[model samples]
Target: MSFKNDALAYHSEGRPGKIEVTLSKPCHTQQDLSYAYTPGVAEPCREIAKDPAAAAAYTAKSNLVAVITDGTAVLGLGNIGPLASKPVMEGKGVLFKRFADVDVFDLELATTDADAFIRTVEALEPTFGGINLEDIAAPDCFYIENELKKRLNIPVFHDDQHGTAVISGAALLNACEIQGKSVSDIQVVFSGAGSAAVSCARHYIRLGVTPENILMCDSKGLIYKGRADISGTYKEEFAQSTQARSLADALQGADLFAGLSTGGIVSGDMVRTMNERPIIFAMANPDPEITYEEACAAAPDCIMATGRSDYPNQVNNVLGFPFIFRGALDVGASAINEEMKVAATMALADLAKTGDVPEMVLNAYGCSSMKFGRDYIIPKPLDPRVLVEESYYVARAAVDSGVATRTIDDWDAYRRSLEDLAEGIQ
Candidate 1:
């Protein structure tokens, strides 16, 4: 059968969905049922009621994350509604389990209203260790995450924004290193002005990319200071006081080009105008701003990456979120802060620089060679080192940044803990 039919059959054939709940403890006998429901369960319940933090110990809340979404922006599918978005959310839960052994309960909210969405998620704080905001549209997504983060003590992450930022930031660091270009010195042009674009600019700024050196372009020409239609907090934040009116104008002499916009928006002519060894991340999913073939033909000197796996350097978000949340949840972190994200990004960059590709990773990608160069600027998603190293760095950052409620005094033991988690042990 074809892919579409196969996917429909896979989800509908057996369980009717991708995820289900299984008993952690058996309840086959009368004694087990009494302990599970009436008396023994009440003991943990009363303990949790006496001390709220006891919930983390007596319940499954510590390792649980809610993959919450309103389905406003269902990736390439685009606003397919909550029911249609369930499969994707379940897929995300699968990644969380497969990568970090973190438990997930995928929650798809039917309301598209930002206030309703925020309130719904806030009410769910008791059930999950963290809230992962997914596939919500741009401005609303921003509003929801900000309000939720302030209202709830748990980590609130809009994966659409920060996930891309973290993974792309890692790729950007490696690309800059290979090209011998300093972050502060480079003129970066972004070909989109939505959540990912604005968030990336903010993240790059935190990573040492100069704000004034960056230019963001939307459907309208450049997001310049005097643009009439400019609105929203993030758009205003990235607005530049520049004379460059178009993407092509901004690309001239630019050292980096980041495309989070629609596919095929960038032409070969635009790539030709960039500075020597320019880094281009044409990260539109299923397609890119410029095709890999066209980009090579345009500027052979350019180091390029895309969102497609078929390409050499694919900037995938799977390289992030799972490990990030793993570290955050493991440390009992109050929030996923900038320091933690930077640690993850730098860890990724450092890992790639080591040029140590595991045989399993190579076999997974079906590649004979994987080294630190133009072709391999970031680590593969299946690399087990990401769980140990990235989560280790993130957990350490959380502790140092004062966001962690729990402490890890033994570094060696902490590494072992992460190793155990990666091995699917609690």
Candidate 2:
């Protein structure tokens, strides 16, 4: 059956979409309404006026995240428009609640203009604890995030960018560890220089990737340092060393191929050009830049991954987002900086080592556990540790960095608390 038909049938059968919003606080009587609404609300407002930070203690703002998307880049079906992106947005909202006990209001932006997007989010910022920009396409995503951060004091994070970076970086760290390579010593080739690619490059560099070793490619070709192969405000930022006419050239002796591009962008023939045991993350949704089977056959020792569920290492952003924002907001983070992401990556990489997640998590990735080997260098999307142990690392990183407004002294206790939150909220 078709996905649309199945979704409609399922939703029709079971209310098909999201249900009614439940109150966090009780509102059983008239007195409750008076307190929740008219008279009781004023006291908290007055206190917030006296000390702005008090808002976190008294209101849901600290735990609330605005899941904003424009439907411009909604999954594999790109540019489906805002209304159509509702189900996906709502699903994201459910995840926030489930994984991190975060209260999210999924917002399908009415307009697509960069300036309008910025203004709209800025206007809404006062209501949310943090803003999670989801699936908005390139250059515009860049503009919106930069503008919103400038205007709002709350942490503004674009999940597609940072989330992808964090998970991918973690996977890369482990892959390199197993392969006996280092990011600084290798040449990294990235396919698709959109929001995901650029941010990944930026963050990877922040984690010790040298500028000379990174190469970017779009549909047109490689983003060489002086080469005018690709253009656009987005591509210009990380423009580097050599002009890559194709993925084959990009893979020529390249140590890594990080795909944020399209499915089938890289082929079996291209995989042969990489260094031995080349690490390839063909992370295009639904499929990938290169299929794992093909990459494996081409380079027998290759460690492969994708954005799909039926893969060895699925680099899903859900593994990063919930806890990432949890940690950032816990400390009243001013911004979602690169260091926090690196810390997140490190934690995720460690989780891959434990080999002790739910059975379903292993089943989803075609295996139960990958014990420090070629196939198990990354974590699965639903590996549980994402909202479990990882949040503690992120929260601790925030506290250490002094970005956390509300600090939790014990990481082990905090990690358990997150697991509890996930149990109730998710």
Candidate 3:
């Protein structure tokens, strides 16, 4: 059967969709039903009414995240609308459960208006521990996320923006070490100026890349100072004073090229124009700006990565979000702040350097060995260590940053619990 047919059959065979609500507690007996629905439920409701924070203890709100989307930007499909994006949102729920044991309720909103989306999500804070905004378009995504984060007490994360940023930031840390370059000194150029690109540019700066040394470009050439085209957009923050007006122009002597735009836009010649040992993350999905084969043919010394799993150093967001959220939710974090993000990145980078890839992970990828190098710059998504290590670091950071309401009394016990959780899933 064709791949397309197999996918459709898989989703349709057992259930109508990818996800369903399963009972974590028993309700088989008539007495259990009363406890689950009416009289017994009223006790917890009164407790929560007296103290709103009691909801976490009495209900599943602490472990529940809403994977909500406006569906204006569904993967490489683009603007498929809410109903069409259900499958993708449900897939996200599957990952959240399979990876971190987190519960997700996928919510697809039919409206695109930023204010309406924010208002709806804000009103849902009582039902969810976190809000995962997905697949919304760029500028509105920026606005919606900012407004929701400000209005809601729980962690509100846009996986499209920060997930890629965190994962790629980890890869960048390892790549710089192997290439014998300094993070503060490297000249980084971006191929897209959308949410992911803007977020990555900011994240790289936080990771030590100089803001002035970075150049960002959109569909209409480079974003330079005094450019009227990007006056009121998120791209304005990246606009710099430069003579470079095109991607090719920006690539000359550049140490890194981070592509988040459409595929087939970057060529081999453009790769060659970059500095020796240049790190090229041509991460446009389905197809990259430049293929791994073409990039190697152009610059044999360069470290190449893409969004595709067929290539090495794939910057998959699955490596970041699940574990990051697990930590945030465990700590009862008020927000997914910058410190927690950096902690996750650092954990991933450190994991790659351990040179102790688990046997199961190696077998899953059909490889005998994997280590930190030009090829394996980030941990594979299947590696069980990510759940324990990354989540620990993020949780620790949340406590140290003073954003966590609940604190872990014993660090060793917390880590062991995470390991147990990982083992249960495996």
Candidate 4:
């Protein structure tokens, strides 16, 4: 059968969708039903009413995240609307459950107005431990997320922006080591100026890439100083004062190329124009700006990564979000702040260097061995170790950063609990 038919059949075979709510407590008996409903349930309600923080203890709110979207940018399929984006949202729920044992309720809002979306999500804070905003288009995405973060106490994360930043930041750390280059000294070029690309440029700066040394380009051309086209957009933050005015012009002597634009926009000649051992992440979905085969053919020594699974060093966001949220939720974090994000990136980079790829991870990917190198720059999404490593670091950072409402007294026990969650899936 064709791939599309197989996917449709898979989603439709047992159920019409990819996710469902399962009971955490049994209600088989009449007595159990009473406890689950009216009288017994009222006890927890009374306690929560008396102390609003008691909701975390008496309900599932501590473990629940709402995967909310307006569907303006559903994967590579742009602006498909809310109803058409249900499958992707449900699939996101599946990943949250399967990977970190986190419960997700996918909410697709039918409105495109940023204020309306923010208001709706802000009103939902009582129901969720975190808000994961997904697939919303940029500029508006930037506004919505900022407003939501300011208004909501719980962690509000836009996976499209920071997820790519965190994962790629880890890969950049490792790639810099292998190439013997300093991030602060490297010349970086970006092929897209949307949410992910702009966020990545910001994150790489936090990871030590100099802001002035970076060049960013959107669909028009290079985002240079005094570029009239990007006056009020998020791209304004990245506008540089440079003579380089095109993607190819930006690539000359560049040490790193990060592409979040459409496919086939980068060429072999562009790769050759970069400095020796250039690190390239052509991360457009379905197709990259430059294919892995073509990238290697252009610069044999270049460290390459993409958004595809078939290649080594795939910068999959799954490696970050599941574990990052697990940690944030575990600690009752008030926000997914910059400290926690930096901690997650450091954990992933450190994990790759440990060279302790589990046998199961290798078997899952049909490989005999894996280690930190030019090819293995980031931890695989299936490596299981990421759950404990990244989560632990993020939790620790949350507590240290003074954003956590709850604290873990015993670190070892907390790690074991995370390990149990990982083991459950494996």
lDDT of each: 0.90, 0.82, 0.95, 0.94
Query: Which model, 2 or 4, shows the larger TM-score?
Result: 4
Kindly indicate the candidate among 1 and 2 with the higher TM-score. 1
**TM-score: model 1 vs. ground truth:** 0.97
Instruction: Give the range of the ten consecutive residues with the poorest summed lDDT in model 4.
Output: 227-236
Off by over 4 Å in 4: none
Ten residues in sequence with the least summed lDDT for candidate 3? 228-237
Clash pairs detected, candidate 2: 11-16, 98-426, 224-240, 225-240, 225-241, 331-404, 331-405, 332-405
Q: How close is candidate 2 to the true structure, as a TM-score?
A: 0.92
Tens-place lDDT per residue, model 2, 1-426, is: 899888778767765676346788989999999999998999999999999889898888888899999999988888998999988888888777667777888888888898988888888976888899988877788888988888888888999899999999988888988888887898899988888998899888887788778888887777766655445466777676565666688789999999987888787888998998799999988879888889999999988988877666778888888888887777777667666788899888888887567676657656645566776776665666667667777777777777667767676776677777656653
Candidate 1 Cα misplacement greater than 4 A, ranges: 231-233, 424-426
Residue 153 C-alpha lDDT in model 4: 97
Candidate 3 TM-score over all chains jointly: 0.99
Cα-based lDDT at residue 405, candidate 1: 88
The CA lDDT at 415 in model 1 is: 98
TM-score, ranked from best to worst: 4, 3, 1, 2
Candidate 4 residue-wise lDDT, 109-215, digit = tens: 99999999999999989999999999999889999999998999999999999999999999999999999999999999999889999889999999999999999
* All candidates: TM-score: 0.97, 0.92, 0.99, 0.99
**What is model 3's C-alpha RMSD?**
0.9
For model 3, residues 165-268, the per-residue Cα lDDT tens digits are 99999999999999999999999999999999999999999999999999999999999999998897778889999999999999999999999999999899
